[model samples]
Target: MTPETGKTSIPIPERTRPPRAARRGAIAIRFRPGPAAIAAAALVCLLIGLLYLALQIRTIFSDQLKQEYAGLVLEAVERAESARNQVGIWQQLPDATEARAAGYRHARTELAHRLASLAALVNASPSAAPRLSPASFTADADLRDTDAVLGTVSAWWRAQRDADSADVRLRIAHVARTLIASAALLFCMLITALGMYAKRNRLLAGQSHEFEWAALHDAMTGLPNRRKLFATLEAAATKLSARSASCKIAVLYIDLDGFKQVNDSLGHRVGDEFLIAVSKRFRESVRKVDVVARIGGDEFAVLVREFSTNAELGEIARRLIACVVQTDLTMGVGMVSASIGIASFPDSVDDYHRLVAAADEAMYRVKRNGKNSYAFADRAN
Candidate 1:
């Protein structure tokens, strides 16, 4: 209450909040990943995996070629050693015959050819160049110490080959592990992006649905508005046109009597509450298929989809009148009553589009005669 104005203040009720579980459920629904997101993530992972696998296979192939070349070089070294030993044995013969001399020359020539081949192989290999070079084998002439040099070169080549093979295997293993970890990390990132995309889409869809509902329904009473009622009437007329002649549709335009007086005597808040209460009663008084809509302030329209006789519509009108006249104590301020005018397809109005106007005209006739009663459009006409 305000001390200066001496008027009591009514406190507005606080808005009720949703439960924690309900909020969590709403979040889960809004962010749940859709099939399109999952499929896109899977496609990205598959493409990356294929690219990585191709690179790994190429590395393995190159390493295999390296191993094959190393083996060939080792074989060349062995051949050179054998040729050198043959040349030495020929030189150590007791008789100095022409055949022995010719044989020694042939063996030395073969040893020189073998040594050139080993040098070419070793020079071609980039990794072997630091430890073994072409000059290392060719610098020693007369081939007296060739056997000892050959033995050392053979041991070095074998050790280098084993080391290279081990290194290649270790590198491939490390790359495989790294690739696996990178792919897993990429997959996780894609999934998170997919979830975010789905959540945004869900939020947009929810907002769109809310906008559509708000457009069609009355904001205060949550009932169908004038536009929705007209649309329903058009649909009902089209549907009944295809059926038998007995199937008919009707419209009842209702105007509240003495509502303005109540609204003026009491406040607008009471008027709004009274409207909501009566609207609920009007809705409850009709069948599930029937539509009760708030067309204007202190005015409503009811769509009866199918009715066999005028009496059936009259009964519905009486029910609506009762919904208003038998108001609860909370809303019964002043002498509030309902004056309803009924109009049916192929009877009061030739066209379905004119049904509401015809009913409205009849409702005004009721107001002129007395308030709180129902009348047919044909009778009013």
Candidate 2:
């Protein structure tokens, strides 16, 4: 200890950091959006709603303003007309200082005030601003509105000293008023035109549906044609594919046995009537769910969605033959019967044409045996 200055040096303390656990805890705190952020989002939504509400209010207000403005324009026009009449009377008078002249002066003042108010109203909205434009006021066939009338009045007020121009302006103002009246009806006409267009479209849609129906059906018998029958069969085949092996659909291909004889002996008119009667009988004999189609000529087809047994099919076929043969017609030809050929799904394969051919072959077999009988397609021949 060399105590030369007699003052000892002060020792500096070392800095200490926070504990590791405290540091980790501070860092691991997950920041989530708090109540303030939620409130801000809600406020934004409120603001949007308010803005839309304001826009709606503005639209309503603008419409009301337009109606009121139109009324005011009409009133101003009436006043101008009155003023014009007064001016005419005043000019006819020997004394220019007559009560009529004083009345015209008052009318002019009132017209000016009305015009100023109209201008202010037009200037209130940007869209309405067009109402106050020079083009809207011009004395032309193209320019006829509230603005044009107001413009004519303004021009007349300024040009009253010029007698000729004032007279012309008054006439133009009358024309403008007429145009405004007609213009209001223009809206109604447009609405009516739109309604007519919509009605025409609806009619066209109905016609289109009818046309499509006609294309798919026989005009005479009102039964599904070959195209419709094929489509229905294809759909049935798809459905049958999903069913159990035991489940089956039956196709009864029928031909009116004596239809040709009637068609040849009787007129086509009688034949058609007879065919129509046969179609009705066939429709009555089959179940409502069954599809009956007139493929062509006297050839017809019936698709039974689900037929359980061969006996059930035979019963339907017998009914068809009996119904047709029993019906007494105007024609001298006594009676006609149907030869039905039954072909079931899975047994005859799902192919529509092949099924029809098999049924047709079976029908020929029946025709060979007897005209009035029905037969099942034989797998062998």
Candidate 3:
């Protein structure tokens, strides 16, 4: 070695930051959280769960208030009967008959005021029970017809306010207990998740991504939801906005024909299975670049990112119509057809929203003209 180098320093490699994955892997092996830490976490979770249960009691309390108000209505009906009996006694009185008559009139007025309060309550919270207009109740509740008033009050209580408060309280208590237990389990899971996270955060991240995708995509057919469709449409719109003259996007709105009749005849389970099978056929028939989405009940939308001409779109539409007719479904979900409408950007409309509306209107026209066919918005009269 040279004398100058030997005096200056010993040879050493350059230092750099550790890789995130390696550091994360070391975390699990380096330290373990104690039982005390876990217990504290569990307590925090339990408190949060109790807070949720407390909020649910607001709804339970509202139901209890309804029962109390309904009981007041029954008492008013009893007061009406008492007033009628007082009227009879007043007529028989030889002395101080005028004072007794006044008392009867006071009772009648009190009953009317009570019913007015009850009618307001019923209106504030609408009930399926027969309409209880205060004027109608007062008209029918003549002093001579005491029994009718009593009968109506009893019937109202049975229908509108029959839900017992005790039942609501009991159910709430059961749910609270279940949630508390779930909180404990969640705490235990949290620690386990932490341990796994220490080993590999990427794995945990992947699981979270899957849950988010499920929310964005349909559960039944694994297609994009309406929200996803809107996002995709907006993205496409933005890209085409710059090159309005050259670029184009197509939105195909498809509604199944005679689906409701078959769904009603077979049952919802069969209908669901039928839709799943139909979705598979749609995925297979469409271009790989296109986005197929299940937007609503028996309604599917396809977004064509790019297309050459009207003939190209027409060919794709014909294939989709034929796919539905040719595909067979399990669970006895018989022959079904679709009515498809097509609208293109820059070709049909200037606005993106107007483009969607145009497609929807054209689909309805096909439904009216004849079923099991495709119609272009530009061609539709």
Candidate 4:
């Protein structure tokens, strides 16, 4: 408790600056992929899986067709063998009767027709059929020589069928490998697309942050502007009204003395530099929680959020004046100083909305009475 004011002053703890790595982590946390990006990635994966499944199903159907073709070849070979057996049985009969002869001729014709059909089927499949010698089977061969010919044809069909089965398996494997490679390529493309999308989102987010910062802050001095100052005051007022605390919020409306002369005597570049230098000094003169804002030309405002006595506000005003005087010397403008007007919530005005106006009116009073001084809004008259 202060002996002079009889009010308790709550000490505000100093906020420590976070480490560089921790700040970077905070920035990284803000640019995560949204729901749309995740959903698109999932859909791409599903498409890749479905394409692989469809390719595999097609290979299975091809294998089924191959099996059916092999079965048909086998059935034709068996029918030819049965006809050859009947021809042999007819020729083995002892009587040379017309009926027996006719039966033998009929069996021979059937066997020849079946052999021709089997040869035609085998020849149709160029991938599986092997080149056979002309002497291997002939249409004019003797009826008694049918067994050797049938054996040769049977052996060739079996070999061809096995070769075709092996080729089908090889083809299926090639198709599977091709499908896998295609899927991998597609997956890579999708991943690239997702990365590009994420990068675009991050770029847009950074632009939005820039626009927001520009809206509330001055471009020249990098201080909060009038809009930002008003917003902060409104928030502080709401807090004060809710808590009904004894600690008060104050606005120090400051106008630079002899600033117009400097702008007229020196170039605008020098004037801009002068403003920047003084703004830095003003920022350094206050507590970490206090906000220093450049509201307009040659005018700035400092907000003191928590203070116990009027004496503390007076001290801040003195520091601001001294900082301006010191900065002006380095810039070769020795005559420059600050005219500050002090106003407080629940002290000068009933509403926080009038705080800045009241402070502005008080600053004019300082100008009228003599520059380079501070005065209170309530005592301006």
Q: Estimate each model's TM-score.
A: 0.77, 0.51, 0.47, 0.72
Give the best candidate by TM-score: 1
Across 132-237, the per-residue lDDT of candidate 1 in tens digits comes to 4444444336465566557776887788778778867976886788678767867776776777778878999999999989999999999999999999999999
TM-score for candidate 1, residues paired by index? 0.77
Model 1: how far is 126 from its true place, Å? 2.4
Reference-based TM-score, model 4: 0.72
**lDDT accuracy of residue 134 in candidate 4:** 41
Tens digits of lDDT, candidate 3, 1-381:
765645657789888878999888799657655445666666677777777667767667777777777676666556655655655665566777677768666656666665565556555553354546455346336554445645775686765566656666776887778786876588676776677556566776888899889988999899999888878888888987877567789988898887897779877887887788888988898888788999899998888988879788788788777767765344445557889999998788667877677888889989999878988897333
How far off is residue 67 in model 2, in Å? 26
Candidates sorted by TM-score, descending order?
1, 4, 2, 3
**What is the Å distance of residue 218 in model 4 from its true position?**
1.0
- What is the alpha-carbon lDDT of model 4 when measured against the actual structure? 0.82
Instruction: Please give the RMSD to the true structure for each candidate, in Å.
Output: 9.3, 28.5, 33.1, 19.0
The C-alpha stretches of model 3 lying farther than 4 A from their native spots are 1-200, 328-334, 379-381
**Which regions in candidate 4 have their CA more than 4 angstroms from the true location?**
1-67, 82-141, 379-381
Ranking by lDDT: 1, 4, 3, 2
